[model samples]
Target: MLEYLPILYSIFLVISLCSSIILLIPKVSLNYVRIHIGVLTLPPLVALLALIFHVDNIIWGPLHFNTLTWLMAVFVLTVGLIVQRFSVHFLVGDRSYRQYFSLLTLTTAAGSLAWLSDDLRLLLICWGTTLLGLTLTIRLKKEWQVAKKAASTMGRYFTISWFVLLAAILWLTQTTGYWQLSQVMTQDSLALLETWEKTCINLLLVISVLIPAGQWPFQRWILDSAVAPTPISAVMHAGIVNAGGILLTLFAPLFNGSIAQIPLLILASVSVLIGTGIMFVQVDYKRQLVGSTIAQMGFMLIQCALGAYIAAIIHAVLHGLFKSTLFLQAGSALHHDQPLKKSKKPASFIGKFSGIMFGILAAIGFWAASPEDAYQLISAIILGFSVSFAWMQLIVFGHGRIGRISGLILFIAGALVYGLVHTGFHHLLHETIGTGAQPSIPAFLCLMFILFIGSAIGLWLSRNRTSRGFTILYLWLVQLGEPNQAAVESHPKYLTQYMSQGGKKDEFSINIK
Candidate 1:
């Protein structure tokens, strides 16, 4: 019982259960939702503070309760509070407020549980429940057709992912004959898993990981679900999306040898490339952010697959915090009716210039320090640049002129720096591939070349300032309604359909009766 303090500290469950009950009460009012939201915010902060003070004693069995989990919990709670505050303004007196708060609490609780869960079963259950809660919250906003569709799609995706996870767990239990995570992580357990049954379990595990991490076909749900409200979007990306990666980290030791490493790397790489490309074409503010989340998650997964568990976890937390903040800001901007336009003259040129300079410094540092792994490092740098470029393009398309130019400049510079780092790293790797050679001049040259090209492109593109075809194509695709001609032609049909569906007649109503 004492061992479960970390799990118990999850404030969301209490809030969710109580909010649901309150919603059903005859006398309860919309104010109850605000009360619950307020209630839900405390547990995470309390737990985080507790963890920080007692950093050493929080461990329970396989779960190590420490500053990292606490920090993440703090972040989740902070975001939820901000979201709730914003939502209150829009949802004042709205009857569904209780339902919304309930779902929000549930989502946060699920995230906390996933972060704190010591076992795979507990983690998986929490994750699936969180996804379900998010879907239900979206469904509750039935007035928004787009939100409804997004919810439906999310529901299906989550259902399939959880099913895969369950199957994997079952397979693992059958092979190991134990459900405890500690048993599974042992050398004896791994040796037992070398059998045919265990092999099947491993395959299922991989599939399960792919599903939630938004790899391949399963990724569409994430994109579709971005149509949800801002708070929901932030929760999903920052909290829910972090689940699979956290699970992978918990079970990293189980994935030793080539069997797990090679396939995982391949999947991560594929997700990174495909997700980044798709993001480049997205125009909607939320959808572009969602694609960026997917791409970043892929990169995190790649780090995990490469045995860089620490890096992956750090990236996940950092990305979640930054992305959630951005989403919130974007929502605020939209609410204020800010004009999201493309400026002919790029904004933030100084910032882009600074980023480029920093990238150069990083590339040089890596070249001077580690010559042997230069190639792999260089590849990572290039990949990072490509991803950044795609993300910038997304921002530009969604927000227009100033956003577009600033994002483009930043992306171009970032990408170039990444490329330089890759070049230097690659050269280093080649020099030390077989022998134990140290630093190499070739790596430094490669880094320099990458920086030069990146800087040159940044300068050239900034001056050129031509509207790209992709931007126009994206605008057409994501524009909420048809052009004037289509709007005119569809108006009558739309009205007829609405009337047929028993929509309430307004002042402009024509009485068919």
Candidate 2:
């Protein structure tokens, strides 16, 4: 029965594809399609619970099912169901409404299969299909030239990323004499490669993941893609951007002692800083979300660099949940945001001190709890800082004592929730994502120090915003977050066609102002 699970999951994927094709029919009731797709997502999630007590990896032909596979399947399919269900009504009356659902289903199903693939060739094909599906969805609004340009940019980058991954896989297969990802990474086969061969392969692998994850230079593609439909943006940011961490986790063994770690750490650090800056500087709602995705993906990659694959998986899944919800409600956010901006003044020195103190206490507590685990130490410091930042902004800096008190309560509740969730994930993935890839303690500490230094510099600059350095950094981040000119327009081009089709004369005759 367990052996058939892989086949059963493939059947689900096939059904999803067939359903998507049916969705293209003009007469099909979208309500029925929404119900069907949403229901389809339930079985996989329910099936995952059964696997909680069954831990062994299942393999059949080109596919493999394990803890991580099940987890990602749950993520992609769940997000797909939500986005499609929401779009059924949310996108009503749009020109390409039908095509949107079809493309989204295709992308989601293909992405789900990609991670389950055991053969590198199969993974490449499935992942490529996913990327192609996403590109088409972005270009669905063909009436808008900006949308077309954005789609084109994404297509080009995705193409490069796909083929670079292909090249890396082919190189490894040729060297290790196996196309199966699991077999290729086996100790005996991995030992077949010279140190330089392993390093080159890892570097190429890093580049491929970087483009999709939208770190640093490659981030422009995602920033441009903000012009896509809301559901598309949600799935892309919430599901697809997390692909980097997933890829790295699957290939963790390759980076056991590779030099690629240096570049990976450096680039991801830069991406984190730039992404954070972009998030702070951008006022556009969707663009701000995209910036946060960039930074979140950077942190995911950093977790991968630290050889904490399980932690990265947890981060990806949680971030996807929150970011997707934000994107779903993005329509109302433009109106709802005015209420969230009540605290306009800078946080006081006492607020800053309290935040830092809390961070120190949190780090010490975590370290004392688990002094033997180096990864936990690094994780503790990062999470501690995050807690401090949140406390300062949400609790300490508020204008009213009631609001601050309310925030403090919510903050503690959030921490409890996070702790419970993290423990659950660790139990699920710790065995699957092995901790064999340890890092040099001294080097890792040095990298952490540099990261903290960068954070400190940013903090100092935020205080003295009128300084030339701050001004230069602020303008640079703004410029970085700005989409390409071709991808930006005064208004949606489809509006003209819509009005031309049928609109009240008054709306059509309104003054140009």
Candidate 3:
């Protein structure tokens, strides 16, 4: 039993890949979805059973049966079962059902491989394949416009994440002269490198991990790809988002050094705040779900950074189960033409006041949780408050006047809080220092004032506006600039010149003569 664990996973991967191929055959019926789900479910379940059967031996290996890994395994299995059930009902009689199931099998296999992989090369291969499977799944939507846009966005995200991972792997090989996870885990060579070299390597690794976790700047892809079918979204959030945490966990030994761990922790904490902030502003249920997943992934990374491996894994697993259930339910709601139900009665003033008081207490609790200096603590607190407010406002407003005002208020509050925190911690103001420093009073005040002015302008523009308020708010937060502006500015001239020169007929393709 002890010797067969790796072999079991390998066999499962082969069978899953084969099943994915078989699903592509035209002769295969939609019932193949069930079959594919069954195939996908076996590896993780069997692995757990194997571990149980050989508990002593399993616990003795490099991959010990820790609480985190066990919890993660259970969560993955639970999600797989839930997704399987949901797919059976939602995908019945659908034309692309087989294709959907095929991609799911691939994703499941990749996820399992990632979880069980103790080798870097195998892990990277599985990671890339999982991403590819997800991209293909996203493209399966019936609407050409939706599918095309989603595919494009997913493609960009997949490419960037893979590129970052590749660079990190290359750097690891060059510096440590090894690409194996077990080897990297054992090697302390990273500590021997100069501070700058170590910093560069750690930065690359953090970026590589972050891109897939849907950290900001690259997070739009997660939202865009949510246009994919329900189960795919669930799997992407529950299974794929956990990949970075798994990688970080496996490389835990490398992070024992203070220099290595501190920078990574800082980065992860920043991602957590950013992801949480973005999540609060999204109006669409799917996007909200995606944002929540991204935020949770960031939290997982932060746990790993703090060397709380078990805590991170536990959180990741629980998060996956809850998120998967929510996504599946949301999909069902969307399919049934049911809007999210709203509370009928307005809260009494006392209730609202109590809620605000609770929120302030919670903010203070979080501030107490921080390990940073006064400045960093205050900055984090303000950022957290701002995000929480923005999220609440978005939920309450839901694309109307209330939402715009609430969003504007949240933004102003966030800016002001940030400014205050910055100024209170750091004495200097006015000049933006390149290095990380304590927040200063003047800087905090300036940030608040600027943000308040901006919010006022945004609120003014949104009143009785035809455009979507939630979307506008998101654009302001993510800095996506303007939507459809490029097409408006350049498309007509390009189209006219190409048409005059007798270019290709396809609209999606460039029509150079």
Candidate with top lDDT is: 2
Candidate 2 lDDT by residue in tens digits, 186-298: 89999999999988999999999999999987998999998888889889988898999999989998876677887888888888888988999999999899889888898
Better of 1 and 2 by TM-score: 2
Local distance difference test, candidate 2: 0.84
- TM-score of predicted structure 1: 0.68
In each prediction, how many residue pairs overlap at the backbone (N, C-alpha, C within less than 3 A)? 16, 0, 6
lDDT of each: 0.61, 0.84, 0.61
- Between prediction 1 and prediction 2, which has the larger lDDT? 2
> Candidate 3: which pairs clash?
419-444, 422-439, 422-440, 423-440, 423-441, 426-439
The residue-by-residue lDDT of candidate 1 on 412-503, one tens digit each, is 68668755754543342222121222224443343446345545654664566565744554453344211122112323343355558775
Worst 10-residue stretch by lDDT in candidate 2? 504-513
lDDT of 3: 0.61
What is model 1's C-alpha RMSD? 9.9
lDDT of 3 by residue, 1-513 (tens): 555664565577588679779878877654565677677676667666654554322332324333334434545655766786677767654546667767777776666655555556766787788888888887775344555576777777788878877786777767777665656645476655566765566667677777778775566666666656788788888877777776666655554343555545555555555555556666667766776776688668765654555445556666777788888888454555677777645544654554466457656765676555343344455545555555555434345677657766766686587457545422221121112223334433433454355456547655745667655656665543122221123332433555686755432232212
Model 2, position 331, has a per-residue lDDT of: 85
lDDT of 2 at 144: 92
Highest TM-score model number: 2
TM-score of each prediction = 0.68, 0.92, 0.64
Task: Decide which is better by lDDT, 2 or 3.
Answer: 2
